[model samples]
Target: MFLLMSSNSHHWNLMAVASSSASPQEKYDVFLSFRGADTRNTFTSHLYAALCQKKINAFIDDEELKRGEQISPSLLNAIEQSKISLIIFSEGYASSRWCLEELEKILECKNSYGQIVIPVFYGVYPSDVRNQTGTFGKVFDELEKDRQEMLQRWRTALREAANLSGFDSDVIK
Candidate 1:
């Protein structure tokens, strides 16, 4: 199965469904986690369209629903209900509190419910995501000191998600 992000053409497509089998109890085939400003209009949107064409039910949050400081209960619930999660780790992924929160929940679901996690390293190196180096490392300095515990969780999640086998946009196209 391939999640092809054609760099030259700036189009994305899920080249193949990893597995035809799906759990009957699951509400969705996939859950998308991404930084809105980084990929909402381009990569994520095109990927979602590809999933839809394959008749894969996926959950992608609307911009209006992300107006709060905390992640929504429904968004977390969607992660739990999905059979798989495709985390598009872009250049600005770690900078967004929202994206970090979603990453944490996706990993939690993976550990607790056997939900599959496929990390797509888009434009950023997997090592940067794992070690929080380069651009991924900069966001930690700007966060409030009071958020240390939450920040630790985010870092742990990033490291864990980066370790999983998945796609890297830079090498693919």
Candidate 2:
């Protein structure tokens, strides 16, 4: 009877784990989000290399993805497969439509998949990202002028992402 109970418990545990796992299975441990123009060569590259050195599977988009009218399918696939998102907020972050789209997708994953999100205020202030002030404010103003329909969505995404617990790059050593 004791042996039978132990075998059943182990089987149940395996079933529970399988049921709770991600549907498509996560491929990368971390997803790096940033303005390539701002940090691709410096902060982002260094961070990616560090993660790699530590044997952490990180997805950092290598090619310039911003030029495309819409974000590539592969990028979206990468985002969906990532377990965590690290958003590196810099001065020009809010200026690009592509970055904004990525932010929206990341937040969506946070809600749907329980994906962890960590924002990094690289050169800009967190308040700026949260409130859309300074550079962020200017960028939004221009975006709103051009694409009025998308303004609220982008703003919400910014506010939502900024509210999460994250690091201020200036404070880091």
- Winning model by TM-score: 1
For model 1, residues 7-55, the per-residue Cα lDDT tens digits are 4444454555466665666788789999988899988898888888877
**Weakest lDDT window of 10 consecutive positions for candidate 2:** 1-10
- Candidate 2, residue 144: how far the Cα is off, in Å: 5.4
Model 2, position 50: C-alpha lDDT score:
64
Error of 1 at 123 (Å): 0.9
Off by over 4 Å in 1: 1-24, 64-68
> 87-166, model 2: which lDDT tens digit per residue?
99999999888899999999999999888888988888899999999987887677647777788899999999999988
RMSD for all candidates, in order, please.
2.9, 10.7
Candidate 2 has a TM-score of 0.83
TM-scores for all candidates? 0.86, 0.83
